[model samples]
Target chain A: MSAQISFRNLTLGYERHPAVHHLSGEVKQGALLAICGANGAGKSTLLKGIGGALKPLGGSIDRHGLDPREIAYLPQGAEIDRSFPIHVYDMVSMGLWRRAGLFGGIGRADRTKIEHAIAAVGLEGFETRPIGTLSGGQMQRTLFARLLLQDARVILLDEPFTALDAKTVSDLVDLVRRWHGEKRTVIAVLHDFDLVRATFPETLLLARTPVAWGPTAEALGPENLLKARRLGESWRDDALPCSDAA
Target chain B: MSLFDTFFAPFAEFEFMRRALAGVFALSLGAGPVGAFLMLRRMSLTGDAMAHAILPGAAIGFLFAGLNLYAMTAGGLAAGLLVAVGAGVVARATGMKEDASLAAFYLISLALGVLIVSLRGSNVDLLHVLFGTVLGIDDATLMLIAGITTVTLLTLAVVWRPLVLECVDPTFLASVSRSGGVSHIAFLSLVVLNLVGGFHALGTLLSVGLMMLPAATARFFVRDLTALVTTSTLIAFGSGVAGLLVSYHLGTPSGPSIILVAGLAYAGAVILGPIGGLAGRFVPRRHLEA
Candidate 1:
């Protein structure tokens, strides 16, 4: 499989402190990967680096030729104002924004596509309802519908199933599987080991740096998990200044 | 007094009153929606700050051109934008909050503006700039207000979706489009532009009152952006008419009267509106069966 994203010694951080420390890895095209780690393991930061929301502190993230707009990224807790007065349909229609643009009104075909995406998430009746009024499950489903319309080659989901019911998780996981089956790259920051093991073919364990990167079964060994837990606890405030080549 | 005589006769009797109504209407048509967005973005107070931010420039313009409309408008726009951009840059570079930076800058701007105005003009002239003379609006002021309204409405039409998307989900837009930062800066500029426009008729202090009061009023009764903007505009225009009539009948300051009317509407919405009104709590309906 072709390398969809090649990270060459990428060091992403904030204010000179590395959130995702010096790391190098490639996510192959059409690979479904799970990034698993403890709290503050830089999973979301790594996803942000790929999504181009955060610039790498040192090295480059090579997306080959994928435009930033061509990547569908859902951040953890998604900085969305729940009280914003937007209808579910209007919010879903924003998925086609890459094609529709600022002034391009949604055409009849686009409208149908939005409706179909909404229905696929089983939110058909909630089209006109304000997104604020929806339950967390319904909101997640709405986001999944938006992901469906995005049709990106690479999909990055940051804890997409957090606090969601089992049913909603299964339904969204199915969508992730569908994307994987369609030869699209899907990277998710997931905590649930069972879901990660069952759905994700590749796993990258992170603890501010890469702990393991390989097949799910091998990378998630008990020893590796213990080491990751240890590494997470050892965050040093007076750590040696990062050498450029490190 | 009949309805026709009470409502329509004031304007028929005075050209100044007609011009004032026209100016306020145009202002309501533009600033109302702009204010609605400001309130939605939770930058309602930012609009208030920006109003003061434009003061030094307008005062400097007054000092230079002796109340020349174009000079004052240009000067105010420049000052407002300067404070807005400066505050943003300061907040980002120095790690201070934007509101903190803005408050500091606008305070300085306000003091400088008052000093400048007082250097060249009498207390009456200062009062004119501070409180405005809406009933004494010239043709040039009318045209300027109308032109600002037109530009604002047209710009809103073009940037509506991105603006809304930007407000609700800033991170999402960044992933999908590179226009996220651009939209935010553009929205900030629009707020400044509308504030400057409002300054022409309502003056520095009372200008933002028109923008924010109606928006707050609309918020109580409306749930969607379109409805929020529409209702705010209607409320603002209605306040303009009613307030102008009240000012005419009772001989009050037109600017304050208009703002007071909008404030009354806001209070009314809070007390009486159906969505989340105070009255609804006292007069309860049975819970919905979901």
Candidate 2:
């Protein structure tokens, strides 16, 4: 399945203030792309524009000849209410809602898909458990289960790892690499510089305005890295800079 | 008496008893399901608003239409829905908190209802509107209640899944845009209808109390959506029948009696439910697994 998405000079905003201005980019069919950005660089806004959750203030976003629903979007898991008394299985099953069609009951096939997705995410025994009971890592995996159930060729994740442990991060990175092996396009809004350099071949550096977009080796060099750090600190006014990117 | 005789007695009653029973069934049909949604949405206060807002509408309808139950009910429903939507819109536009807006709306509606009743010059009618009379129930009123309940229940059943989905994940659901604001509005409209239906049986205050108490009670015992709805309906039906019987046997007001029974169920659920905060005598082990 060929999955290609293009954002052509897209300007996104809420009300009159623009979040991402004059953005233009293209995701190669079945290519793994990482979006590296400073805080308030409108990475989430750009993703929302591309995902059809928010309409672009200007220009257009085209998903090659497929519907936007064919793309799986895993929003930052922090946005979800963890205290909600919903079972992990039920939460994952919602990803099939688009394909299952409105008013369509969950059948044998849907159940099989849900089970496979859960198992793939390594949540084998947590089907009956409430999502509120899960750890931060487990919650991320549950969201991954939802992404898996969508069965889309294109995956866009917004900060899938913020407070996860080291092992969970590695497991998630491995899952993304597996998706890459299967020729699925993975675009992630990530903060870890080392993870991007090691795992992602292509990187798009954003700092409100487009900073750079190309191979990680070229785009994430010391100068571009310095620029990102400066922009992030400029936004926060007190963000510390440490040489943590190995 | 056998179960058959007890159940069939309502059908075998004269005009007054027949009207009262019909009114109970009508009120339960809409009230039960609507209460379940309100409980899930954590907006049981909106149900309270609907019931309280109906007061002025009923008073005005009585003044203009001269005790015509249908006209008065129509007036109440229209006014209730209007105030409900108006409060919501005002809350959004002004950036005021919903709680503040609801409080303002509730007070205004209550005051307006009382003023209208006072202007109509009948303390007896006002008292009846406050605490309804089963003996005063008539056939036309019964038919109106039945028709309204059937429509609201059917509409609710049709939109049940999406409504539940919206309540569970409103952000994701709204992001997709498949679930629109229309469903929320429709659900609120259903709440208004249920409140209006119950208004005839239990009056305004007692009607809302009965509707909310049963569903809130049902939540502690049930985890699934279907079970919650079923439990709420059963609670409403049982209390309704029991209240009507007690009212007939003893000379107490049916409205308050039914609400009292419903309140008892709520208390029971709180005391004996799986998640109850009782002194841990029958408490289950931590059942939620990761």
Tens digits of per-residue lDDT for model 2 on A1-246?
Answer: 343988787777665356776778788887889888877888888888777877876778888886666678888876676644578888899888676644778999889999998998789999988777789999999888887877788888999888999988888888899899989899999999888989999998887667789999989988987886776522333544323211
DockQ, every prediction: 0.84, 0.26
DockQ for the candidate 1 complex?
A: 0.84
Q: Going through the candidates in order, what is chain B's TM-score? A: 0.92, 0.87
Runs in model 2 with CA error above 4 Å?
A1-3, A58-60, A63-70, A82-85, A233-246, B1-22, B87-124, B281-290
Q: Give per-residue CA lDDT, model 2, range B1-290, as digits (tens).
A: 77656666655765676677768866876778888888778888878777778778877787787777877788788788887777777776676876688778867877977776677577636665677665577777677778888888788766765686677766566544464456777787787777776777777777887678888888777765677777888888888878877776676888888888888888888887774436345655665673
How many collisions between residues are there in candidate 1?
Answer: 0
Local distance difference test values of all predictions, in order = 0.87, 0.77
Q: Please count the clashing residue pairs in each candidate, in the order shown.
A: 0, 1
lDDT of 1 by residue, A1-246 (tens): 989999898888777678887788899999999999998889999999999888888889999999877999887655898888899998888899888888887889998999999998889889999998988889989888998999899999989999999888888888889899999999999999999999998999999889999999989999999999988834567877787645
**Tens-digit per-residue lDDT, B91-160, candidate 1:** 8668798789989988988888777667766542546567888898999989988988898899888778
Give the CAPRI rating of model 2.
Answer: acceptable
Residue pairs clashing in model 2 are: B56-B113
Supply candidate 1's per-residue lDDT for A36: 96
